[model samples]
Target: MACGALLASACAGMPDSGDVEAVKASNAGDSQVRVYAVAPRDNADPEEIVDGFLEAMTSDDPGFATARKYLTKRAAQSWKPEQSITVLTNAPHRGQADRPGDPDNEGRTFPLTGRRIAQVDVRHAYRPEVPSAFDTGIHVVQQPVGDGKTKEWRIDSLPPGLVLGEADFLRNYRAVNKYYFASDENWVVADPVYIRQRQDPVTRMDPVTQTVKALLEGPTKWLGPAVDSRFPSGTELARDVRSLAPDDQSKLRIPLNGKADRVSGVVCKGMAAQLLFTLGDLTSVRVEQVEILGSGGTSLCLLTKGQAEQEYSPVREPGRGENPYFVDDRQRLMTLEAGGRQPDKPAGVPGPFGKGTVQLGPVAVNRTEDRAAAVLDNGHELRVGSLTSDEELPEAVVTSVAPRLEDRLSAPSWDGRGDLWVADRNPVKPRLWLVPGGQGERVEVGTPWLRDGTRIESLRVSADGVRIALLVTRDDRTTLQIGRVGRGVVDGHEEITVKDLQDAAPRLESVTAVSWAGPSRLVVVGTEAGGVQQVRYVQTDGSTSATSVLPGLNGVTSVAAPYADQSAPVVADSGNDGVVRLVPGANWQPVAKGGRVPVYPG
Candidate 1:
């Protein structure tokens, strides 16, 4: 049960003389170093006795010898042959007897497991008996354990008495044999316990000790005041109510069948506020509504199931199947399924679905006459109906066309843009696809080099549709490549490499997004150890500078420079805490409290 007993038993096979010599040599430079002895209990198992000896050294009972039995042979043989170990005196006590007639219990008695534990507190003293072997200041304490019956106890487990030394006592002794066995008798005492504890000066904070007081205490002390402080008046409650609709006179409707109180309004963008309503473990709620702030402002627009019916059609034709589509009634963006239609089948040939010319269904948004578009998943595009919807979508007008090579037909951008860039990771050709604008055709950009297994971690396009920035990572190193829209060669295009910018700011990990900060300057948002970095580039003069805009953020995943003045910088962080923080200016202020932000109104 002794702490060192296990380690001692574990290293028991090590040669005793070599271990002793090594310990002596390691202590040669320390004048105060001394060895203690332990006595073995009568009738104790040899293995258990050795375990107890090691345990006393380490202030634990199971001992080093017993613990060493479980170690691999390589670990046991790695001990130095010429190390010296200290022994401690024995303080024995009897063990409690087991209950009578216990089937599993043997009549074997042992030492008191708790009382046998001891500590040989090593004290480093300055004086040395031999000036040549020991230094004036360096001192060490060594605690050696042994059987309870003899004062000459075999060293088990590393003696705790050795100060500023390795846990591997034998190894230390072998490395510094010249300093071994030089003890100071003046420092030796029958009992060497109860030493005063010292506190770390740099980190410790003592209210009474003004001279030793830390400057700012711990790290939490620096941040705790702000995190725990109260918010500005009405700022907390201002975000409580749902934001009013853009139009003052619009009506609001509830989409689901539940209590409105269950919904929690998280954020408001322009006139619409995003709400999260909780129903039960099986269901959660999300709704965007327009709130009325005060007089003259419009009533909130809460879309109801009844109103949604007026906006959507649920009929399925034999030739044209019905496609489920998502619609935001507030935004008037109607998503209708398209392309899942079938033509009459021929006499001998089966259709796509074992019938005839099949339609995969299409999604259309009602805007005006002759302007409706349909999207398909297989990279195909089509025109659904006239932009002006005089009636329900006409199936006969659907026309299929090749998608833009750079278009992603199936997965559209959340911003209602028909064309979204998606990297084709088909292994054969890694390329970028621009999902056709308004769903007509897709355009493929970039070279086949992407198919050669280069991973594109992030991609960003300039607002003017001229420049494209991509963060490509290979073999744990990330490289930023910026190219013009029509360019196939990344290096050949007008680009900025991240490696070149390391001289100015060394902590930039990866560039997430790039935007034009001004006519002659470009803003680069990067992920750094301290958080998001906002770098300003003067392209005309080739001058660049970076500032730590956001601190304590894990990484910046996305960045948006919405305003021309670069006053509003929107950044998304995908860290342990998934929060999309908006830093407006020099002092970064969080626009949204939590992760998901409201996308209505603005």
Candidate 2:
């Protein structure tokens, strides 16, 4: 069968391509882009054939037809790449085994093995399960022709999927979050999307340019309808964009086509926000300002990341409408003033959770610090009430959920819009719940990333409501994963779901907690392979920095970072050393003794 015939056979009875709406965006321009792969040569050994095949897989070729050249005609036709793609964490190992082949006995059988990063299914969903499950074998055959003196080793048998080393994979694959507005315009969600670029991400200007290109191409097919963009339809960068760019000052100049020529200033800034948030995420580029240009390279407006945050008003700001609050050992909910580091006395504490019989389970304050949600009876029931200073207490309990002690609710997190989000750790009924601010409507949001048997230990929605941090425990290992939130109309109603889930802290074996330290940084408390507990600062893309995670935070039970920027890290000592905080270039300062689980408003 022909190559097209083989692929056609796979999708034989599926919906029409136009109606299916599953077209994938291509990364190639008119010029071919090669990603460091040499063509195969005659008389190649089985190992060389295998190495060449793996290298060809890294090419940005559509359907990897170039990679199949190393395989025998029969094997290439039989290969079904749509089955699955195993992303390797390291380079694959190649070895030969005794088998019948050439006179030298070196062109017959081979095996490949590696530690995988993830497995992406046919529908493009990423699965981060047992990464060491792949160990494949390949058989090679020599194509007899002309004189038998020249032997050519071609793969006769191999398994599905592509394998690449960590370095190459990092160079080829880049993650960018496409910005979309929540049902409430006040909030914008970042939908994480991975795109391939012909040029390396380390190259100057390429990272930002390619990222902005991907953003303009629009969200992936699966997530398109769930989000919206400010960039007009068919918007693209002008052919000659560099002439307008200010490379010295790390400025990005994007000249869109005519589709977005006359967009309002608000729309242009929102477009800039999307680009700034997306490009600023690149490990290689530091985007200070984005200049939105129109046709003919005419400048429309200029915006900075800080200005974007203000104009969009997406992220929740700490100390804006929030006051300090904590639960004491006596089950009292204490409040602290703006400058005071310690809470008030138990007698001076406020709220019903302090006076009621509910034992004061894990508590979370709203974005405004005027409402509190607490779990009761070891996580069976949850209730919400007003936190106003002079308001009348609820006559009785306000709202409650299914009561079961075996499964509990993780700490609740509130978004900037005053909506509360909580996860039920119930294995039988595991779910994430969202309670709208005023109406108090509880809705169950679907999170496919929350695989079965995986328990969500902690969940925190970013102040901007675009990203979420989760501590998931599975198979006795805890890891931190972040996903972009996508909200849109579904079944004629507003629905929010988490998409593009990726592990943010893959090196950590046991993660106890996670908190957003900055717009793109996460402060995590976890342990490495040796089981030595420590705190780490990591980016949303899993990259680490020296100053991201503060030092001297060991034996820290709970950790908290301000929503805006790095301040003194407030920590709860694990060994009763008292609640201490670390200041850069200084010593640890004690905040309050015996405090755990420090948190900001949202």
Candidate 3:
């Protein structure tokens, strides 16, 4: 059946049921086209030099050599490019102060300041370390040139890291996943980040070295503690080599610095998997085997493509997702096992979910299939319960303490590590939190970019646990954004934060529901124009195709496709019909007609 049902209620507002505010139809396409940063000239002034150097930092120029032109030879070599980054919204203003109490002024401090929004350290970490009253200071040295006819002003010292506007940042950097294993050492989760990729595709510049370097730079702030890596500290490629291009045999010999030498055999095996997965992430870098080379070009280990699976693997598509499950007309959680056409309602274990007057909205089943999280009492509260109703819904792990409409929580999601992730939109206590499965202690995660006047409408954590899809509404416009989840440490305690929040479908006007459809793709619903409800495919990096629409299914209140399938079966919460699954190039098979949210195993 070509299921066609459209209502303003279908793809708008919070999940479950509630009084929903209507939003205008809008279109969010794929990407915002950006140009490469222009290189700076040699004879610019201190102010221009500073600005140009900062701008050049966004460029994927080899080694940032172009940016080095703005500094003195000594400063250029001493400046640590990765020490920290100051996120700014505008151009920095230069102010100079002469030496205090000096009748004859010898030197001055060049102070540059702007509206610094956020700061990140080299570890790709954040912790309010960048002060609100932050400013970069540069020491100006007025010295004589060759003939001393003309004075040359060179920067002696400057603040660490780079600074750039949000616009330039979006244009210049692209977010890619660095793979890591879940806490239980079961599956790999991605650590997503905005790293600069070489823009000039025509040059055929290999990103392997760069990607490996960023991977070596370590996981971002929010993901550090949750995951582990085999790559040792101070890990770097030999100074003589920058890129890890493969040879004719499709083998890459990654020469590591001394830091990785003299390692145990078991550690070598783990390190091999790390290099394989890390380098394999780059779109341009293709290799069949990765050989770990120690100092003096000693062969430490080699990992073939096939061997990588045994040691460790990615969480992208673990081949573990199950058939669609949803609440039936009897208010019970039922799995749809194909029988004839509709489905057989095989009740999971224990009592039926959403029985009687107990209403349930969206339900998230962890990848392990042992438990599921759901919203109850008409969005007034959230509970993590056993899928088979084996245990009473987990004691309202999250709820609307504020009793405000905006304070309502979204359905919970489970990462590969089996952690429960939920969001609270209460403007007073807007937060993203994690509940370790079966555990009560609530660990609050931070979202630094969540500005005022914008509230989270819907959220889904990635299977990997490193990325999240958020439906945010601001000024009546609902947009789909993707955020990188990470972790940091302070005073021996762990802190979690999300970084590099970017629009995944910026051209779409309204996005009702979003679900991970592949490793780097999302199935998004909403209209490009005319309130024409349709399911569209979108990339996590904010790239969408104008014609990438799944036309048949309309007015889908909810939808689910395997995160690894670009053209996976379409599981839809069809209006008034409950739940249905439309396999690719196949007919619609009814699962249940009274279910609202249809989901695949997490």
* Residue range 1-602, candidate 3, lDDT tens digits: 11022221112332324544322112111123322233433344555555555555554455666566556678879877666667654545557654657756545577877766555566544322222455767776655556877665566787777775545444544556676665546456666555555432222224566667677777766666667777777887777564567899989888889999988877777777777776666666678898889988999988887677544655533444346667666666666653334344444434436353467766887776667777774776777666545455547777766576556787677776678888887777677778877356778888777777678888788776767888888888988887777766889967777777767766567888888876667888877656677788876655433455775675677788776533446688878776777766667666666766877766
Residues 1-602, model 1: lDDT tens digits: 11132222222212223333112212222222333222343334434444443332321112222223322234324432112223111222224323338665332322232111112112211111111111111111112234434432122232223222223222222110000000111110010011111111111311111111111011111112111111111221122222212223433331211122222332121112111110000011122232322222323234332222222111111122222122121212222112222211111111121121233222333211124333333544433433333344434222223244323332222111223444443334344556445343555554434534565554544332333445665555555554434323365643211111111122356555443332223445565566545443322112222232444344444333331223334433333333243444433333323222111100
Which residue pairs collide in model 2, if any?
Answer: none
Q: Residues 1-602, candidate 2, lDDT per residue (tens digit)?
A: 11131211111112222222111112222122234334566566667677667766665545566667788778888887545566666666677665665676645667777776665444333444444655887778786545756657788878775565554444455545666555446445555554454442222235456567667877644445445788888898876442233478888788888888989988888788888777766666677899988987798889987777666656544225334455555566665443345423213345576565557666677776667777664666567767665345443222334365546677788877777888888776678888788236677777886776887888888876766888887887888887767777889987888777778877677788877765656778888788777777776656443344556555766666665544434444444764455544666666556554556567
Q: List runs of model 1 lying over 4 Å from the truth.
A: 1-420, 487-507, 512-543, 546-552, 563-565, 574-586, 593-602
What TM-score would every model get versus the actual structure? 0.27, 0.68, 0.60
Candidate 2 residue-pair clash tally: 0
- Residue-level error in angstroms, candidate 1, position 487: 8.0
Location of the lowest summed lDDT over 10 successive residues in candidate 3: 1-10
* Deviation from native of the Cα of residue 466 in model 1, angstroms: 2.4
* Cα RMSD to the true fold for all candidates: 27.8, 11.0, 13.5
Best candidate per TM-score, number?
Answer: 2
Q: What is each predicted model's overall lDDT from 0 to 1?
A: 0.28, 0.63, 0.65
